[model samples]
Target: MSSLQFNAVLLEISNQLSAEQLEQIKFLCRDMIRKRELETIDTGRKLFNILTERGRLGADNKECLCELLREIQRHDLSDKLNRFESQSGSTDNQPDDEEKAKLDIATEVISENLGKSWRKLGRKLGLTDVKLESIYKRHPTELEEMAVELLKEWRKIRGAEARTEELIKALRACQYNLTADKVEHRLATR
Candidate 1:
């Protein structure tokens, strides 16, 4: 059954209980919720049995029952607030390291290929050269973009025919060229 419906029933029970009996009920509900066993129909049945057996849900127990219901509602509301904060990412105090590394690498690669020294690039990007270098070190995937840019620059300098021939030789001698597949495999194995 829904938590709201269950809560309504608990409230009804609370109206018929005494303060001490309500405390007992609150303690039991807290224990059940903590154990993750309070969501089952059988748990509700067990609760009802306990109340009936103890004469805690009768006319004499009304005040206690109400107090217990309030406690349970308070606990439920606290749990809901916690969940909402967590889902909204408001509870995460730290940035994801891996994601930050990737972004840093991408920025470094772009700066390198664009023919700007890291210090110059850093000035333009509003970061320090050391910070840019650190990013490249952490996420080497950035090298792929730099390699592509290097090839484009080489083509412009050496002409298409020479650049194509050099690339073919580099591909064949995998050790000589920093290709994406080889770099990725090396990184993964390391």
Candidate 2:
């Protein structure tokens, strides 16, 4: 199926959702989508747009959307999404072998080299301050563990939408250029 078909399906699903259901979705996605942004999203199309822009929704990754549907007790919608995936012959949000390798390398490089700036990187990657503090408290003086946990938390929240490129971009944004470069170099060599 084409993107047009996928979008049409989303639009149909969005149209079926009640206003309260939309609010539930926004609430469920609070970790990935900012509260300020969520407040402005009064429509499903806009919500989907934000999800798309934030890398939470795409042809290659629909698990987040499906999970949100299930969270809201909308199994019918989730089934619809799954049907679309099957019809489109898309993988169930599984990364290809090369992408998986890149993500693994990126995770290792970022975790080891993140150092004392893990919180900053987390913030740059859209993790909340509360979440960062929780992570810090968990590892306390173990910065490497904290970094690894931070990345793991991010991945958990992002689901299949989490990509090595996104992590590298966050590293660059947080001024961890060398770490980002290391990820890029490792990915390139592999």
Candidate 3:
């Protein structure tokens, strides 16, 4: 999903929220949003824009919003968001042949350089602990394969939002700066 699409989703979700729920969201985000600013805001779109501007919401990251929805006991809204994400992936109609080839090469380079830090990168990429354990169990002695599998799983979950930049960010977050640079250089030179 693009930021525009993500914003649309957030707006749709915000429209569904009750006034009390909006206040609750503002309260929950007190630390990140200033009290004066919160008082001035009375709409979900504004709050979402602030969050997005702060890097708290995006196509590659929706955890905060999802958690907020769940915290507010709005599982239905959360599900609505998730459904949009999954369907957006399909509507994107898959990558072209060239993009697919580039992704394959990038994945190969990332998997090899990732080494034993695959799990850390996986966690940073939003893979659950249980999913990481399952991947590990499936390839106890194969580091490269484990890394590739983890990347594949992440790609599956992220779908259209799965970009090389997001992978680079996750790699850097896991302290794999060299690997991230390599990935960026590789994609650039391609």
* Candidate achieving the largest TM-score: 3
| Best-performing candidate as measured by lDDT | 2
Candidate 1, run of 10 with poorest lDDT? 155-164
Q: lDDT tens digits, residues 1-190, model 1?
A: 3344445555544343445544455466664343343333244345655554556543234344444544654332222233333333333433356533432343333334433232332333233333344334444565545444343333222322332234334433433233324433433554
Global local distance difference test of model 3? 0.81
- Cα deviation at 107, candidate 1, in Å, is 60
Candidate lDDT scores, in order, read: 0.40, 0.82, 0.81
lDDT of 3 by residue, 88-187 (tens): 8776745566766666877999988888878888889888776687678779999999999998777767665577778777878888899888887888
| Model 1 spans > 4 angstroms off | 1-42, 74-190
**RMSD (CA, Å), each prediction:** 22.4, 13.4, 13.1
- Pitting candidate 2 against candidate 3, the one with the higher lDDT is 2
lDDT of 2 by residue, 30-147 (tens): 9998889989999999999999998989877889999999898777677667766664564445456766677778888888898998989888888777668757766899988999
Q: What lDDT score is found at residue 157 in candidate 1?
A: 28
TM-score on alpha carbons, each prediction: 0.20, 0.50, 0.51
Better of 1 and 3 by TM-score: 3
Q: Rank the candidates by TM-score, best first.
A: 3, 2, 1
